[model samples]
Structure formats: structure tokens, C-alpha cells
Target: MQGYKKETELLTKLLLEILPILKAQYNLEEYQSKDFRTGDIACMKSLLSRLKHLKTSKFFSTASSDEDLKLKLKVDAYEKTAKNDQKVIAILKNKEKGLEQRIRELEKANKEAVALKKSMERKDEKLREVMRYNTVLKAKLEC
Candidate 1:
């Protein structure tokens, strides 16, 4: 009886760890389409099969109300995790938009500075002509 209890205890712990982790990994973009790796799928399937077997056996009843209570708590936790995931995704999207706008503003400022530099270069040509004219007049007066 102790051996059976220990086996189920270990399996229950394994089940507790597997379900949420598999659910999270399965939803990732890399696994969204036909891109899901065979190995990951196989592992998930194995875990699910074991979980099903554990839940159905007489051994499951050994823990009685404890298992049922734990399951309810785990489900509640998962529900809250879903909401948190959505909030995180929304915040990330907002951050990305802000970063993109900042990049556009920086690019615009760079273009305007370049244009101002070209305008100054054009004015510098005329200024050189005026300086030359003044120097010639000064030399003529001295002579």
C-alpha cells in the first residue's frame, strides 16, 4: 500500500508540472502551425496519456479529496495566468509602437539637419564673393 501511495504521489507531482508547461509551449508561434516539432508533440502526448491513466486508476482515489482540491486550485491559477498573458502582450505592443514613433522622429530630425547644412554651404559661397570684393577695394585705396 505504501508503494502504491508513493508511486501515485510521484506521478501526481509529475502531472502538476507537465500540464501548464505543455500548454504554454504548445501555444508558442514556433509551434503555431506545422512548425511544431515532433519531439515536443511526442512528449506532450506521453504526459497526457500518463495523466489520463493516473486519473482513472484506483490509486487516484487513495488521495481522495486532496487531489480534487488541488485540481481546482490549479485550474483557478491557470485562469489568472491567461489574463496576465494578455496584459503582457498588450503592454509589449504599446511599447513597440512608441519605439517605432521615436525612430521616425529621429530620422526626420536627421534629414532636417542635413538640409540645413546644405543651405549654409550655399550661403558660404556668396559670403566668400563679398569678402573678395572688400579686399580689392582696400588694396586700391592703399595704392
Candidate 2:
């Protein structure tokens, strides 16, 4: 009886671990396509088959209600994980948009700075020319 209990516990733990992995793998875009790896599918199928067998076995029958309760817990866990992931994705998307806007603002500021620099250079050249003309007129008057 103790051995059977241990076996059931181990099986439940394995199912819990495998559920998350399967969820993650299946959720991936690459795995959603027809080109998904056969090996992963085969492995998941076998694991599910074993889990089904364990669930239907007489050894686990006495605790069938416990198994059902655990299954419910698993479902709840998966749902919570999915919701948290969505929240994180939304936050990251907002952050990305903010960064993009910052980049555009920085680019516009850079362009304005460049134009201002050119304007200043032109003003400096004009001032130098005026000084040269004033010097030439003064020399002519002295002559």
C-alpha cells in the first residue's frame, strides 16, 4: 500500500512537471506549425498514455477524488501562469513603444542641433568679413 501511494505521488509530480513543458512547447510559434518536431509529439503522447493508464488503474482508484482535485489545481496554476505572461507581454510592449518614441525625439533634436550649428558658422563668417571691410576703409583714409 505504501509502495502504491509512492508510485501515485511520483506519477502526479511527473504529470505536473510535464504539463508546464508541454504548454510552453505547444505555445511556441514554431511548434504550432505543421513542421513541429515529431520526436516531441511522440514523447508527449507516450507520457499522456502512461498518465491515463495510471489514472485508470485500480491502485489509484481509491484516491480518484484526490487525483481530480490535483488536476483542478493544475488547471488553475496554468491559467494563472498564462495571465501573468500576458501582463508581462503587455508591459514590455508599452516599454518598447516608449523607447521608440524617445528615439524619434532624439533624432529630431539632433537635426535641430545640426541646423543651429550651421547657422552659427555662417554668422561668424559674416562678422569676420565686416571686420575686414572696416580695416580696409581705415587704411584708405590714412593713405
Candidate 3:
């Protein structure tokens, strides 16, 4: 009986030491109630079983595998593609700016052409009036 009690005490001590570490590593929440006793063998056994399961599962392994490396390579490739796309967008924006400036220049030239055409039309009308007046005066002199 004494030996069994000693074993129980030792188990409790071990559990106290390991529990904090496991909780920190796995981001685990406290499973026991606030009023729960600290040295319950059942609780310690349950925790030990959980730890064993975690060790046997892939969740505990930190070593990078081939799959992880492949994923990293894919991420790098995608980043490169994103950079190239951004460059293309920047180039297109510059072209758009150039086109806008060209449009403005063409519009200004069109306005100037229209103004010149109107001025020429007015001058032609004045010339026709002068020719008609000259013809009338020549006709009066002949008479």
C-alpha cells in the first residue's frame, strides 16, 4: 500500500510538471474544473493518454516534408507572377496617359481648323460683295 501511494505521488508530481508544457505547446485550454483536485490519478492518466496520442499523430511533427517544400515553391511562383502582373498594369497605365494627352492635342487642333474655316468663309463672302459692286459701277458708266 505504501509503495502504491508513493507511485501515485510520483505520478502526480510528473503530471504537474508536464501539464503546463503540453498546454503551452498545443495551445490547450484547461480541461479540469476549478474545484478539481490536483493529484487525481484518473486525470493524470487521461492527460498522459492524450500526450501519447499527440506524439503518435502527425500534429506533433515539425520536420518539413516534401509536400511542404512543394507548397513553398508554388507560393514563390505565384508571387513572381503577381509581380509580373503589376508591371504589366503599370505599363498599361502609362500608355493610357499617353493616349489621353494625344486626344487632347487632336481636339485642340480640330478647334483651330474649325475657326480657320469660318474665317475663310467670311472673307469669301466679302470678296463676292466687292465684285458685285464693281460690275454695277461699270454698267452705269457704259450707259
Candidate 1, which ten residues in sequence have the lowest lDDT sum? Answer: 28-37
Cα error, residue 23 of model 1, in Å, equals 23
Answer with 1 or 3, whichever has the higher lDDT: 3
Candidate 3: RMSD to truth: 14.6
lDDT of 2 by residue, 8-119 (tens): 5564555555455445533422222222222244444556565466566553454546556456546656787899999999999999999999999999999999999999
- lDDT per residue as tens, model 1, 1-143: 89965665564554445445434634322222221222244444565565456567553444456556356546656776889999999999999999999999999999999999999998998899888999999999999
Off by over 4 Å in 3: 1-63
| TM-score quality measure for candidate 2 | 0.52
When sorted by TM-score, best at the front, the candidate numbers are: 3, 2, 1
How much is the lDDT of residue 28 in candidate 2?
25
Q: State in Å the error of residue 111, model 2.
A: 0.6
Instruction: Give the candidate order by descending lDDT.
Output: 3, 2, 1
lDDT of 3 by residue, 44-110 (tens): 6677677667656564454265345335445545676789899999999999999999999999999
TM-score to native of every candidate shown: 0.49, 0.52, 0.52
Evaluate candidate 2 by giving its C-alpha RMSD to the native, one decimal.
11.1
